[model samples]
Target: MSALMLDPASGSSVGLLVAGLIVLVGAVVQGSIGYGLNLLAGPLLALIDPALVPVPVLMIACVQAALAVVREHKHTEWRGVGWAMVGRLPGNVLGVLAVASLPLAQFNIVIGVSVLVCVGLSMLSLKLSPTRPGLVVAGAASGAFGTASSIGGPPIALLYQHSTGPVVRATLGAYFLLASISSVVTLLIAGQVRVEHLSAAAVLLPFMLAGFAASGPLRKFLRGPRLRYAVLGVAAASAMFLILRNLF
Candidate 1:
């Protein structure tokens, strides 16, 4: 990718403010539910400024994941995380290859459609427990999608949706922490990482953290069935948006 692929976003501007607002809202959603930040922020940021994506967005998201891990450290499923990471490492490689060769529209369309299918199946009472094999597959999918598009939570979150809220949040937090960091490293190696991405992340960090702080109440409210439905709805909505954007 050329250096201009992600335009430099510097200085104070209306666009920056708008981007921060989006980040704030997304952080609240993800902070409360375990996954929604990128699904919510990515498209809007692209519309607002191409420079705000893939790197800057992912950076702040890592921060949110870290907070989740710390808050729910006791609830983390370490064995599950290790199993998923087994697949995630390779999946990240595949994602890098996809970004290197696959057409953007094609890649986005495929991911969106795949995610929608998973959501639809789950809605049909398709019970998917976080088994070792299941976690591996989901982890792989998360790594590929997270690295390729930054929408990695659904595959793993959907699995934990049937479980408790704290488990869902903490497990996903642990898994995504590694995924986001790995994706950034991939970008850095590809020569896609830049100072502008860091600057944009710095500007957006406060708003994202504010959203996280504000989610304390909302998180209390969204639990059990509410959280399960949220996983399905957000995953489906995000997938549809991605598909439409690429198609049009």
Candidate 2:
């Protein structure tokens, strides 16, 4: 409570309300498509209050993923998920290393540029299939990028661009479920998980769930090829967002 800068009488802060709205919007977007929560919410939340980020946001993401998994679990590619998680393990370590040792701006530039290049490459003949090796590679890349930049969906989302909407959402939900849990656990081990984090997350969960509920209607409109374009657009936008974020 004190950590959130809440008013004792009201039991909340204006910044927190603003953050909940942002999370709601991000959640709706992510629920309709397969990703975009972090891309949409991370910056805005940081501007509102830096403490709203990372821990609390990640907690909501984990819950959102869990709900998504339940929502479309049947469409998930279980085999691909297993392989991707395997790759994610090592990739997560690499991301930690890069974050600790590399120059922030330069490293972010490379990551952002690489994501953009990958988007461009997808337009060519380098389409990724859901084979074990492809999934593993994509998963590893996602892990590294996500760990390094807190934006992991592009790699996995790109791999599943050609898949059906349900497949894309469900598979990503599963991947994020495992990955988010892993990340939170890691943070806990590092003593980054605190009471304030849980407080913030609790405050935001309702809004997040509301956004997910609102997204049910939007999903119908994003079916088929439209969903692919949406994913690609979100991915490209996130890449640019990352580049711009670090440059300034």
Q: Which candidate is the best by lDDT?
A: 1
- Predicted candidate 2 versus true structure: per-residue lDDT over 126-193, tens digit per residue: 87668888888887887777765567778888888899889989999999889877766766675667
Q: Each candidate: how many clashes?
A: 0, 0
TM-score of 1: 0.94
- Deviation of model 2 at 229, angstroms: 0.4
Give the residue spans of candidate 2 off by over 4 A. Answer: 1-12
Per-model TM against the reference: 0.94, 0.90
Off by over 4 Å in 1: 1-9
Tens-digit lDDT track for model 1 on 48-140? 766666788889889999999999889999898889888888888888899889997799899999999999899896898899999999989
**Over the full model, what C-alpha lDDT does candidate 1 score relative to the true structure?**
0.85
